[model samples]
Target: MPGVADGQGLGPVLTVPNLISFTRLLGVPLFLYLFLATDATGWAIAVLAVGGLSDWVDGFAARRLKQVSRLGELLDPLADRLYILATLIALTVKDVVPWWFTIALLGREAVMVLCLVVLRILGHGPPPVHYVGKTATAILLMGFPMMLLARFSEAARPWALPSGWALLWWGIVLYWVAAVLYFIQAGIHVRAGRAAAAGAS
Candidate 1:
């Protein structure tokens, strides 16, 4: 998720956009239940479609209505991550994608976590969301639904599968590239902080 502007206060917690993000978060478990427990592929896809659409809607609404808040910023990305993780688990369980594919994506997330930790230790919060990272996320979100469609719908299998894989591959590449950029950014900040501290001492 994108960070608030510099000097912007963490606005109120309650807002329309935050509510939309919360709704998207709730759909994550429902998606898992529909896809995994009930075998309702169609409904699961419907839930995913709504989640993806709402992702965009909430962002637009936030900007348009000036309802952006710290909580909304957090909730938006949290919802996206939860949906991606849920879909990955479901896809792995169904044998639609290989275990390594899932792990590779998750591994990128782990790297991000480490980067955040390193930054925090240096008295810095997370850096602003990079455009490349946002693009990767958008691509992955779109790719997963197409992959599910390709897997379950015979009619869509021909085109959806190839296109889905293409998107996923591109998304993964960009995902790792973003991770590397974030890591480098963190290192630079840490080094700069230390240099200043040393000079001060």
Candidate 2:
């Protein structure tokens, strides 16, 4: 495993691995446009699946090709959030997924991002992706598209709704756990930073 220290000069951005992430970001608007403009839920789901697969592809390529970029890491999550948030909002407008659930999920994501941004401004880069956070994202990404499909397709309705809801609940749980872990991790780093500053003074 390559630590930040091990790869001082190696750039992770602008590589094949990161190109996949850029593709995912590009998919975000496409998915949103498809869902918003068309009644083609099946097509939307298929496109969303392609976007999701791009997520996996980028990460795998990064590891295999050693092209992991800091920008890619940030871009990947942003793309995921944009895609999921748009779909959830669209569904809510159509009276499928509840507004409350969408709000809750989006709120968590927003707060975490704000926290990371603040930390970065304070001279600490965004924290590494915790496993729990990654898992939560995967669940949410996979679940939301299915949930959207169920909203418009009767054939996908039976299992997709329940399964999507189940995945949603699990994702929520994992997100909260990850949030707690992030808080603890941030607190420790904050204290350490403060102590170091005091020592320097």
Candidate 3:
């Protein structure tokens, strides 16, 4: 969603909500660093859980604290993407998840981002964050913890492996579906904006 706020006045960046968003931005790299440094399953689960918590915390603070800024809106999704990307990379590196999964996840995100960039250049606004998108993200976040637990838990926890795999696959499917929807919605917005602009002239 590059430059979606170009002409819009999103207000100052010092507000509480924007501060939370900044914190989320910082958290993304930190989470990645933690995962990269530790090979322990326990550490992975802990850091991932905290990363997920940061996702929720920033949004909650933004809305409740009434400090929402355009920068915050922009950075939130970006942070989420970065966090997911890091986990996907880590999971692939550890062999807990297949390489195909990482490729697909990253490919979808790349496509969505390209669409957003194209839309912005075409004079269209950023696509609305659809419900499907939200659900997709939630599923992925939930899947990561389950996957981590599966890796760390002992043989006594028989359900962890299967449940974690199931959740991970389901989340990947949902994310793909959501990515399709995002592109479709972006196309609609672009067309509408173009038509409006043409008619105005």
Tens-digit lDDT string for candidate 1 (66-139):
87788777887788788878888888999988899999999988888877887887798776667787778778
- lDDT per residue for candidate 2 within 26-76, as digits (tens), equals 877787777788776677788887876565677787779776777667776
TM-score of each: 0.87, 0.86, 0.83
Clashing pairs in 3: none
lDDT of 1 at 45: 86
Q: How well does candidate 2 score on lDDT at residue 197?
A: 98
Instruction: Name the top lDDT candidate.
Output: 1
**Better by TM-score, candidate 3 or 2:** 2
- 10 residues in a row with least lDDT, candidate 3: 1-10
lDDT minimum window of 10 residues, candidate 1: 1-10
Clashing residue pairs, backbone N/CA/C < 3 A, model 1:
none
**Comparing 1 and 2 by TM-score, which wins?**
1
**Deviation (Å) of 59 in candidate 1:** 2.1
Error of 1 at 51 (Å): 1.5
Ranking by lDDT: 1, 2, 3
lDDT of 3 by residue, 16-62 (tens): 65666666667666666666675655665776776676666766777
